[model samples]
Target: MITAKNPVHAALFLVLAFFSAGGIWMLLHAEFLAIALVMVYVGAVMVLFLFVVMMLDINLERIRQGFWSYLPIGALIGILMLAEMVVVLGSRYFGLEHVPQPAEFPAGYSNTKELGRLLYTDYVYPFELASIVLLVAMIAAVALTLRKRKSVKALDPAKQIAVKRDDRVRIVSMDAEKK
Candidate 1:
């Protein structure tokens, strides 16, 4: 995806990456997380991304021109992420000996319920904050797309509702059907 020239292809690669990560979660017995990852990121987010890429008029030439200018910042971000990952993976807690395998649950136990319990109870504030952030993003996207265009005509509901019969129609008495 890093080397993909097309933005659409890059987004598709991201979907593949999400699927792979979800598969890994499934292997680790995180069924709820795996399904959530596939459903939310792959099903919803990637479809939105694909729609955006298809609808937008992107100039490849302009993108290529700005590549060099963006490279430095991109590389800095990549390096920072790499360093963070390395630190986390190299931590003692991540070692096999330090990490214990989770005990198998009974057949009737539901991972989804447990996850929801934890999310709504212990992490309610963060969950609400994420929802607010998503709501803001959705509103911002709508606002961005609703830019004023002189060529496009729109009706005001207030004006429409305020109109009286006398304002919209003129009655003609003498000029009626002089066939």
Candidate 2:
């Protein structure tokens, strides 16, 4: 019996609650970590979830028709994702080398400051590339949504600009009819 309205409101409330707690966490000196978590999850992931929910229509029966057909592919994708996570997190277990930790900083050095410095100095190119990729994606999305319809009457802006006011205006006067 759960409807769309209930789930949408619940998700909005959850996101609001998360941001409220995150703001408090930031005040408690975990500013960078808290903001990053909020930005990545609440900002990006939640917006993506909302976008997909609003854009796509789902029919349970139609979807269920292909459940068995896609089960093996879905399972394979899931296993690959899990395996990738294990490989990334299990580096120590696999005897891979680790970078030596830097010497402890003085009291004034903040984690956020250090992270920013590293990102700007070492990862700046990759960061710029990511932004360019996002821009291209946005442009592609806009282009995909734009279509020309033959049946619709559309105005040409260039023609409008070239037109004189007299061409579009007409004046007429009506007098009482003679008995």
Which RMSD values do the candidates have, in order? 4.1, 6.5
Candidate 2 per-residue lDDT, tens place, 1-179, comes to: 12224445656776787788788767655679788879987998878777776676756576457667888898899899999988886878653244322344466868799779988999999989999999999999999999989999999999989999789998889998998
- For model 2, state the Cα shift of residue 89 in Å: 3.8
- What is the Å distance of residue 78 in model 2 from its true position? 5.2
Cα RMSD for candidate 2? 6.5
lDDT of candidates 1 onward, in order: 0.89, 0.75
TM-score, one value per model:
0.66, 0.55
Residue 11's C-alpha lDDT in candidate 2? 62
The clash tally of candidate 2 reads: 0
**Clashes by residue pair, model 2:** none
